[model samples]
Target: MSESIGPVLRVIGCAEADLPAGPARQVAELEAAVWPGSSPGHDPALTPRTMLLVDGAGTVAAALSLLYKPVPLAGRTYRAAGLSSVVARPELRGRGLGGRLVAAARAELAADPAVDLALFSCDRPLAAFYEAAGFEVLPGTVLVGGTPEEPLATDHPGFDKVVLAAFFTDGPGRDRAAFTGVRVPLHPGDTDRLW
Candidate 1:
């Protein structure tokens, strides 16, 4: 189902076919507009996932990608949803669109029995925003590109040392913890910190 928060904001599920041909390019443009040089992955269409679009007055204002199923780690299996490519138009900040998009994404994930947790990376400043939305700061170090030296930075508050956060569908540790204290490699020089 879809939801409309107001005249300027409409939330709806979009299919892979609905995503434009150059989604990576489009996502790059959105990331650049908001965070300058961070390279976000653009492969939602290649995965078993759902895309949520937040449009403002018929224009694409924001987008979120949610991936379902287990993420295979070194020796463990974890059931979680991967959230990525969350973006909002540069001119539309502070209007509650981001939060609304997150809420909608969370709601969608919660309804799925296969998903036990939600995982994503965000720069420091927006950590509180996600925290307020029901995500808790997982204890551990986040290494960017498998190197702890390349720290992720952002203007969102309380996230200066955090590069990512994991939100549990049933609280922390009740279900398996995906990638606990694990390092996920990011692309080199891709510092667009918008998450």
Candidate 2:
């Protein structure tokens, strides 16, 4: 799906596997630039879908990936999609492009009936940035990643993380209390741990 945000700017969405070579390379480069030392591609096992904000010149101005799966939380399962690898071109920071892209992604998830909620962890300082895009901090909540035997948590030492979520389904919204003040096991496996 693609939407025209302006005459010279547009936002497009596609499964990561279906992304063309040029745009995929651009997304990978943006990811590596923003997050040094990390692999420059999406984890196919995570069922990632790419969202890109492209300029008139076909340059990827901002990008983020959405990963979908069933997440167990508070003794129940919820269809969840997480926001990952959110980044913008280095020269484009502070221009609100990232935030706009985030908000657009949130809206896209909200429209998907299959998604019960959107949940992910962000660095403490970026909480406010995500909050402005319609995500609420799930206080005292920690997401446990990796396998159950080898887990990584947001609350681990040296990590300043905050769990943020947007409940899309009525049931999940009403059951919000079950999410807060608890540790939710995501177990997305070793690759892309803590996404």
Candidate 3:
């Protein structure tokens, strides 16, 4: 890989039938490093499409997944593209590779006419990182993940979370003040913690 500024970036769709095994395996390795164990769906990258930052030699430097699902909000269902499983190689931490990849995901979502907004949650310490990448911290927003049988909301006791969001289209995001100081339901389902 180059020691220069940027690394190769690619956005892969879940239905990418031709994704080569090499990159796929590299993605799996990167995911495993961050998620050492298994869960319902394990990782969002394992579901919909993915965005990857591959080194010059084709090794995954940082990665995240873009999964879209309809969530009932404000008495309407909105098409949201949620970012999940974002990770950067441990050795490359301070290089801003993760930020670059995050920014790329935002750009992709912002440009998509079909996408309503870009939403996700991160720990309080990481809130600044996502904000630098253009995601606004939703003051009191809570994303609900988990199965319908046992739902999990970010605002639940003993859990500290910060919702990072970017409103792209006209409907839901038109009123910016609404998102602040209010709790909103994302409802990504039980398969993912907070896709």
Highest TM-score scorer: 2
Q: Where does candidate 1 stray beyond 4 Å?
A: 20-28, 35-41, 44-56, 72-76, 141-172, 176-195
Q: Write the per-residue lDDT of candidate 1 for residues 1-195, one digit (tens) a residue.
A: 578877656777655446555543565578777767655554442343435454553466667766544544445455656566677777877887777788778777767777666766666677888777666655463534312365443322464555444545555554325445655433223332222
TM-score for each model: 0.65, 0.96, 0.84
Which digits, one per residue and each the tens of the lDDT, describe model 3 over residues 1-195?
Answer: 112335354433343233467777777777777778643133443346666777567787887777877766665666788888888988889988889888878887888888888878888899999999999988887777776667788888978899888988675455445556666666566567667
The candidate, 2 or 3, that scores higher on TM-score is 2
Which model, 1 or 2, shows the larger lDDT?
A: 2
Q: Model 2, residue 1: what's the lDDT?
A: 78
Give the C-alpha miss distance for residue 76 in model 1, angstroms: 4.6
Q: After superposition, how far is residue 136 of candidate 3 from its true place, in Å?
A: 0.2
lDDT per residue as tens, model 2, 1-195: 788877787899999899899999998888887777889655688899999999987899999999988987667789989998999999989988899899999999999999998999999999999999999999999999978999999999999999999988887666578778888888888777887
lDDT of 2 at 45: 81
Off by over 4 Å in 3: 1-18, 39-47, 171-173
Error in Å for residue 20 of model 3: 2.5
Order of the predicted models by lDDT, top scorer first: 2, 3, 1
Model 1 steric clash pairs: 37-192, 38-191, 38-192, 124-159, 125-156, 125-157, 126-156, 145-186
**Ranking 1 against 3 by lDDT, winner:** 3
